[model samples]
Target: MMRPRRLPPCLAAAILTATAVAVLLLSASSPGGALLASRQSPPPPARPEWGPGRPPSFAYWISGTRNDSRRALRLLRAVYHPRNRYLLHLDAAADAAEREAMAEAVRGEPAWREFRNVDVVGEAYAVDRTGSSALAAALHGAAVLLKVGAHWDWLVTLSAADYPLVTQDDLLYAFSSVPRDLNFIDHTSDLGWKEHERFEKLIVDPSLYMDRNTEPFPGTGTRPMPDAFKIFTGSPWVILSRNFTEHCVYGLDNLPRKLLMYFANTAYSVEAYFQTLICNSSDFRNTTVNGDLRYFVWDDPPGLDPLVLNESHFQNMVNSSTAFARRFEEDAPVLKKIDDELLNGSSVQLVPGIWCSNLSKEQGRMDVESCLKWGDINTVRPGHSGEKLWRYISTISQTRGCS
Candidate 1:
């Protein structure tokens, strides 16, 4: 092809500068660009005044995948509290429309809108529950919560399949006396059969690279265990203190990053990453409480996932004294039972709490209208369930020592 005519040096410089300015303006107008600019701005405003003796707030990262939008919303409503922060994530399996719908639903809630405490992960990536991607997603959620919620004392990760056995009022009352630094994580140093099959075995998750979800496949060669830090594994579901979460996310020490790299190729790293990190770190080791504070019923020979909970499991779940439970079929009747007996409200309602009472009075609405009345959000009034939870936590804390 014939050579194109070249512009003069000064003219070309002017054209390039003009193009750069145009591109900058375009980016500054886009939503992603606006978000980037906002991050560079000052941190979110200081936390609202938590009155004396107020219960500590929790930052919840509720994640789900395809077809889990409604279920996740229900779970959010069940656990909703004006003081706590909520971050919802529907993974890559969920289409953009579903994610938007979730965001819209959250925005539609009067309390959620008024408090402005709930957020939806707008840009989501693939996550393989069986592989390191799950760990990555959890960390991402933690990081986001740390950024968005400056006042929350704890970080709790939940999936759509999980549901609360106790209301927010009951949970807050139960935890009101708890030390803010304690971590409720079910962990054990004993690897048992998992040492060979999980720790030593190598696997790669396709979801990390592929757009679609796929199971992780094992490699032919196995690797040796690490001597640097002992491996600890447990339930992936955990309630982590802000202090420990900050350690994992910010990595003041190299331990968290080092273990993260080591677990990238390991099977089900989500189960072990936080456990190992907390147990290995001197600052956080002593803070572990050795219980996830969640209840579940597993098969006689426990399978990969816990059994789906239903109406029959209601009594046992209630007696377990756990704040949360898992693996419930969507809209299971047991959830309704928990709502009626423990929550004192319907599933769609926002678990009546002190905040609910206050919000009702502020709006001049009837005291009984919509479960929102005026009471002190600072103080917690525990019920029989809260008493049970407190006793359970106290018993566990006394028996379990972090080594």
Candidate 2:
């Protein structure tokens, strides 16, 4: 008998890549898979309405480190809307129990359970937020969102320390008027001091190769900035257009992947990677809005991190007309105030919106509402806060072909 012909190496690799992407897109994440298997799975959610007539949906990537499960969950509740999709990732610092507990907590929520749009990443990995590891984690998240969330207009990334200043209704309503292809990222090509300190330095991120991430250290000498493409730096937080995120993850164009390799050894790569990538790509360059849509107050000359928000900042936070703010202590009194006043919610309840108003609507005896179904999920009822966000967004016009 003639020997069977072997498949070409390139063809085999392409097949494997296609298979992996399909698997990621089709399945619920690891722990969630187990949860689904343990009980009867909820029916797949109806496809969200897209286009100018309907409000845009978001894909949120919420990351936390160590014992931040509770805070991350709190953030999720504050930002929750049935219309949106969420992916939660707790780094290796968080124990497996914590990860499992978070997954369980998600399952406990009636709306989350009913809608089944939320998931916990089944695996654990270390990430130093200052290194290429963080950028990798972010790219990983965008890829997962692209695969799992069949359609969403934008990808919003937040940390455990970050909190929403406006409700999802407000967010969706504000974005409704904006172009679907626009990207909300703060970027400036004026590298200034960062040219030497961040871009020119050669650093090795242990997290890239090691099981647990260690501190990233610099080499003896620095290299010159690249002449191939200009570099832009800005806030690490961004609301990226789904189209741009697809470019980053799928590498349909080579620019995204090329920048990814160059930034792998640079410090605080997350701060510059997306900014650089978006500003460099001719296709996406004109789509920029030059703002992350988050509120933050740095120190006088600025420090490594933004100042921690407190009760003092509450009034200003409200007046800032921004959608989100950062660096809050876990369960701060300010948070409760935000819930009660701005969000029209409590710690126990999700921020009420078009999908569901009563997460715990129950009578004394047996007349309890089924959390599985609520009002029209396609519509939104925006409050005064929504108006402010829309106005703010309108002011930040599109980029003039990337500085």
Candidate 3:
């Protein structure tokens, strides 16, 4: 389930196609060229919550391409915590100017400067998610985070369409009780329809060698499925443990690297790589929880994309124990509701957490602009929803162990 982090396969293509038009207007767009003139902007003012790093952290890999910069920033605010590490990537399809703009926005944020945890990939390559390149992009991000050395316990992969369902405090609190080695991945050995459609086909990703992104091309013949390893498939989204991430990034054993080469020619290998590796490796296969920890609504035929969420899904979204939900429109009203009710976010400020040292009454709600002074980052105070998540994890975690 902890597949590579990249934009959706089809979406990346569409974004790359628009690069030509975007470049034409780059000079005229302030948002696109704003950061080019100034590269060393000061960091956000220091807040009390994270004065000198006293808490466990998360390393988030959030990626998008082209026009997705705005959505990426919004997601950053929603999940931003001084104690966590963030790496943002806009694929090669986007113009360098556009990527610079995104980085500029990050540089302008005082909070990011103070913590020095948020980073953007200055150089990127086209990543076609349908092929194995998506896995490459994800591994690249993990390697970058590992090099950053921020002491993160987990790696969470997310896209622009994804949104957090709980505050960072609630999420950290709920996960604190569970063992850090436990990876939440939903996997089944039964390949079902994908056996022939995905596993049997040999495809080549043009992004691997070409400067532009393109659809994968089918090879002449089909290959027999392998008995050397059992194939498992499930939701591509995953919450992976730090140790497993290291194994994938550094490849302590030959299996992880060997599987990467085998999957390079397989279609939609992102859906297969991690699933097969964990199930096939004795060291990690038993550490899985058999859940991706995400809430998604599938269509009847279950096409390539999940159903786009709207207002009607609001109640269900909040009620779910999952930490995140997906396939939302860029500015869906449901997102506003999630911000208002769950995250306490607004147009100007992000979701407030225990790290926010001060709060004031404004418009009938609490306003937390910044951490300003100081607060304990190590401690977490879970909200009401955290209790439900705790019970669910405690109950299901016992029964599900990579079975």
Candidate 4:
């Protein structure tokens, strides 16, 4: 693919630097240590392979707010791969200067240049997780990812606070044997305590129409919760299939459209929109596996946000068997541990994969032969933990989805 020059997302400013660019090219002795030398070496020539022969590719929509550009880049590198697609967005909360710098940084990466699969949204949109505006932003990202390419099978949404528990290779290998149509979203129809506060009550998100942030307003009147369609709600984080995403974005389904309008007046609609829409549509309900493929710890009573993960959460995070986890503090030391122990990633270099060949550890750079060459993009070679993930998925797969 011809490389496309685009701006970096809000969190990748250092990605634009020539020095930092070469730093990633160089190999490191340890994950957190200084770069040592180039370790790239030429390999015997072979004809390039493509399509199902390689690992499955993902389309990632990584979103964050102001002052989150660096953390976004770190997460990006942690999950980066040549075959997958990425779309980054910084909400209106970030100023124009931060947004532009992020875009420029993405353009500076050699691997991103060779594959041309990464992009940052230059335009700004208002978003507040406290209301429906966050869902609007997510859907907007899905629209942009669709416009970027047609090759990806799934769409995963992540925040700057989230980090991977496994490498791209580990994640791909674990998912390779599974059906592509299934979505990993934790959902439930049993609203429990949320029925009165979330379903019956109504609120307005001024971010939907206002140029600046405004608190949500309670509706003057309350409406009985609808039985027209079963209401479902879950974690906002999701790994959605491209087919289902298309259903939400372009399908001629009235339920999806109706739910969007209904949830516009609901608080924290990002958590409810897809859950309600997917379960209501008989076509998609069976396809749901009811897992978000992420690990998170909620405060008791479950406040507006989850606990911010730190070093103390490291061991549990690794043992969770989830692909990712969230609410991590920026530049947490635990992240460095993950890069070293799990992903085999360096401080700034992307998590290595089969796609990356000819790495040089001594000189700390990829030689002229270091450009990402194509391999079996659809196949996967799972690691030790990858097998465990497959087993966990199998168990989750057997349980009938939430009623």
lDDT of 3 by residue, 1-403 (tens): 1112332323222222222211111111123323334344333434424322333468898988778888888998889877788888878778888877877777665566556677777666778878877777777666667666347888998987898988888787777777778888888887788999888888988887666766789987898989888888887788888888877765567777678778888888878788888888888887889877788999998989899998899899878788899988888889888888887775456566666545322534755444444355567778887777777777667755454
All candidates in order of lDDT, best leading: 2, 1, 3, 4
List residue ranges in candidate 1 displaced over 4 A: 1-48, 358-375
lDDT of each: 0.74, 0.78, 0.72, 0.72
**TM-score of each candidate structure, all chains considered together:** 0.84, 0.88, 0.85, 0.84
Task: Give per-residue lDDT, candidate 4, residue 339.
Answer: 75
Model 1 C-alpha lDDT per residue in residues 306-396, reported as the tens digit of each score:
9888888888888888989988988888887877787776656567776654322224453322333334556567778878888888777
lDDT of 3: 0.72
Candidate 2 error regions (>4 Å): 1-47, 359-373, 398-400
Model 2: how far is 195 from its true place, Å? 0.8
Alpha-carbon runs more than 4 Å astray in model 4: 1-54, 357-380
lDDT of 4 by residue, 1-403 (tens): 2222332221112111211211111111112222125533223223233455455678998999899989888888888876678878777788889877776666555566545677777667677778887877777667666656577878999998899888787787776667788888889988987898987999988877775556788887788989788888989999888888887776675776678778878888889888888888878888899888898888897887889888898899878989899888887788888877887766577766666633322244542323334444344556777888888887787663558
* Worst lDDT 10-window in candidate 2: 1-10
